[model samples]
Target: MARLEVRQSWLGDVLGLSQSVVSKRLRGLLPFTGPELLLIASAMNISLGELLGGIVNEKNPHPVDGGSSGVAGGRLDLPTSRL
Candidate 1:
């Protein structure tokens, strides 16, 4: 059996972006756009949850319709209490 490897260049190809862009995103110089994230999730043959890095929280319900609240895949954790 051969080893399956994932590389930045491969990811770049999957995202239709240059390797430098992928590197920049990896290094936090740029943010991963929503489409890029979806493509990456597809290319890796992984679920969105796995691609999201296990940030699911059953206790905290996220806002719908693109609300700027709740934990965004571990990016943040905001208080859900409406005061």
Candidate 2:
């Protein structure tokens, strides 16, 4: 998602997290909460399932809507996954 955002020139300064924290989280060395997941998804303009990918059972799932695609306040519904 980050890659896609960068490609689209939509990547912005990450809010509420330090560079080290962002690095660790992106490198799979740290865990993120449900709300955090939602924030990340909202920042990247994608669905939580798309962000969580393999952890979510995409074949059988509920759809999410009313999310923001801009760089502002958007509703984020994080998936309940044990990642």
Candidate 3:
């Protein structure tokens, strides 16, 4: 959107999220909620399916965990672990 000259604040307003939250999502620290993604798609004039087609599974958005656990609130444990 930046390349298209879209304002970050406008995008945040459209998604109903704070600018900081949007920045976190852009930095990959947090994932966008389902509704937020849909709003983003609308803002970009694209369908939700096309917006997330290859990035996420359209059939089932919440993918299976496959038994892999992580840190609190779905954030992966990225710090170096002591053996």
Q: Which candidate number has the best TM-score?
A: 1
Model 2 whole-model lDDT (C-alpha atoms):
0.47
Which candidate wins on lDDT? 3
Stretches off by above 4 angstroms in model 1 are 1-4, 54-83
Write the number of the candidate with greater lDDT, choosing between 2 and 3.
3
Please, what are the lDDT tens digits per residue for candidate 1 over residues 54-78? 4444653432223232234314221
Model 3 per-residue lDDT at 63:
23
TM-score of 2: 0.53
- Supply candidate 3's per-residue lDDT for 37: 62
TM-score of each: 0.61, 0.53, 0.57
Point out where model 3 deviates above 4 Å.
57-83
RMSD to true structure for each model, in Å: 10.5, 9.9, 9.8
**Per-residue lDDT over 1-83 for candidate 2, one digit per residue giving the tens place of the 0 to 100 score:** 43452321222254566656545555445555556667667887888778766544555243223222321122222331322
Q: On a 0 to 100 scale, what is the lDDT of residue 65 in model 3?
A: 48
Q: What is the C-alpha lDDT of each candidate?
A: 0.53, 0.47, 0.53
Candidate 3 per-residue C-alpha lDDT over 4-73 given as tens digits, one digit per residue, 9 for 90 to 100: 4565567778877787876666555875555566577788887755655544455545422421321123
